[model samples]
Target: MKNVSADAINALKAQCRGEVLLRDDAGYEAARQIWNGMFDRLPGIIVRCVGTGDVIKAVNFGRDHELLISVKGGGHNSAGNAVCDDGLMIDLSLMRRVNVDPKKKTLRVDGGALLGDMDDESQLYGLAVSGGGIISHTGVGGLTLGGGFGWISRKHGLAIDNLISAEVVTSDGKLLTASAGENPELFWGLRGGGGNFGIVTSFVFKCVAIGPEVYSGLIVKKFEDAKEYIKFHRDYVRTLPDDMTVWMVVRHAPPLPFLPNEVHGKMVVVVPFVWLGNEAEGKAFIKPIQEATPSHGEAFGMNPWVGWQSGFDGLVGHGARNYWKSHHIKGLSDDCIDKIIAFGDTMPSPECEIFIPHMEGAPSHVPADETAFSYRETPFVLNIHTRWQNPSDDKRCIAWARDFHAATEPFAKGVYVNFLSEEGEGRVKEAYTEAVWERLVQVKQKYDPQNLFRMNQNIKP
Candidate 1:
């Protein structure tokens, strides 16, 4: 990190339309804080960028001074790459703005905007964007760049498939547009390579006509039956239509109104699904899972898309200490099923759980080399979502997740970049195939030779 002089800092502050806070400033603490509480790094300076102009100014200042830059786009990465210790943090949370063009079947979202923000805008016109995260607060930038998958991903495609164009500011301080016909290679890299190439200012994604109301909710079963249900699901779900997507989870049961009082705080297997088409058809889609396991609780019917998207918000809200380990698996092999049940039965915390998102429809058809998300062919992704509220329980929670993840190593195809932590370069390499990694490196060298944007799942030049 370069020595940031007072005069240079003042110059940067004057150039932006937003606030710039030093480490000692009043709002600095809040500005530097990210989604996960486990990472406790303090930035030397925090710039609350309000728009593209602010982002440009901040990037130029950091580049000129060779300052270690950490960019924050809603700050929701589990790896805590949004902010870094002793660097200049470019905070884009305040730049959230969503524009919906219903007739064009497109939605343009600001780089810093959250999924909830985009949903609120697009849903107003009875339009929907595919491939948003389950949590509404997840930023459009990181999620989309890393091949975002949501309830509608199986039907529509990953967020990158819907991405028409991206407005970006490169390391050279020039703004550029990347799409199929413009900066095509950069476009491919951005789709799944993450925020390494540049600072994405805005993204225009192709939208699909989806439900203002659809069938979506959770069904709970005993934790002990997780392996059996998973075995049934691994085969049954492959037969389901693309309009319906199911993600299986095993964790301590929440005290939702549907669950029995005796089940509250007890371990359970949760099967949650969302159907993009008709309500009746959606209910029928998930019927097999309910029949496979003796359900302790079930809730399935027509519900607003906004409600379902934000459904998991309370459970994994910000400020919790979260450490996650994820793997793209071939299927629910016998060994994988056994390990999932083994880990699910002994969750360290109520919030700690396993998430197996099955995305094997439209997203998988895209050629692996076509985009930076090389693990597209994978059918099941296991995420050891380790979360806790207490500081003391961090070790136990993280250890359990690590052990579970390591135990399933033999069954993994590769790692998903989005669910990756600040793991070593070896693990990061696993996120991409050698061919894709080489291409990404070439793109990184062309756009960011100095590696200015190294905060994400970095593809170092």
Candidate 2:
């Protein structure tokens, strides 16, 4: 890309309603920082867009000036695609506004909105979207774009499956709306195609009926019983109904009151879940896990689903260096469970964890060709989340995750795109089938032929 002229830059600042920042600008540093601490790239320009109009100006400015471009929504992607060096960074953090229609059972969220922000607003009407990552502060744009899933996902499908429509600004600087009736192909690609098509300014989602509270929390067990517990969990989950979702975590026990002090900071298996039903039914549903293993600790109760979604926020908060390696497991073979426990026994950091999320039921019901998201047949996803402070521990934590991922590679068929880091194109291809990848490329060529939105898990035009 060619350098932007000073005169053109000044014109963009004058035209945009929001702030257009440069290197020496007061807020440039803060605007350019992303969730992943490892990336320290200094963008040449940063545009904090407050509304869709400002987004148009920024896109046009970058396009006309032939500058390298990047879009920063909530800046939570571990790959650091939200911001880049020597480029124009369009920061949408200020555009976080959510509007809910109770009559229609839908929500329209701005691109800059965080998952928690959406939840806070939507839950007021006893309506919810099947969204949010473990960290509530994650951006809605990236998460939904890459096939969102959570505790509720097993019951109601992924966020992309519930997405009804979206407003996007293409590389040509033209605003377009995508839905089933208009730009159908674009809508299909946007389901799990990442940010390659365009800058999505807003999303319209079909909400599900949910209460203020649900049965949710964790069941902790000692490391010694992990093998038997995993075996039981593997079989038990298959028998569970769609409304009950459970995932496993292997990590050192925190100083929560439920656990005995003797078990604090020791290896433990935690089974966290959300039951979308009455407390009586939930208790019965969760009883089998407790019976299967003599739990060292347990914490389960009826809680607010909206608030419970962000329960892991403090563990994976902002400014921590995070590297994640993940896979879509077909089934939990004895060998696979043993390998997971072997590496999890020696977790390198307190912040790191071995996450085994159940991805069955509702998400699998979506036909493979209906959306860009593949791997619908997958039952589980193992995320080796490596998060730690201190730049010195980066090598140690990252190596552990990679080695663990390699050990379990044979058991996985594909991968969940959202959990992937900056692995290359081969890994990206693994996230989709040949047909879906080709369809994405066609959509890319139609909307962003010049590849201006190549900062994400890119689909080449």
Clashes of each: 0, 0
Each model's Cα RMSD: 1.1, 1.2
Candidate 2, poorest ten consecutive residues by summed lDDT: 1-10
Clashing pairs in 2: none
lDDT of each: 0.89, 0.89
Shift in Å, residue 237, candidate 1: 0.7
lDDT of 1 by residue, 321-407 (tens): 999999999888898899888888788988887888898999988877778888888999999999989999978888998899899
Error of 1 at 144 (Å): 0.9
Worst 10 residues of 1 by lDDT: 276-285
Top candidate on lDDT is: 2
lDDT of 2 at 199: 88
Q: Give the poorly placed runs of model 1, Cα more than 4 Å off.
A: none
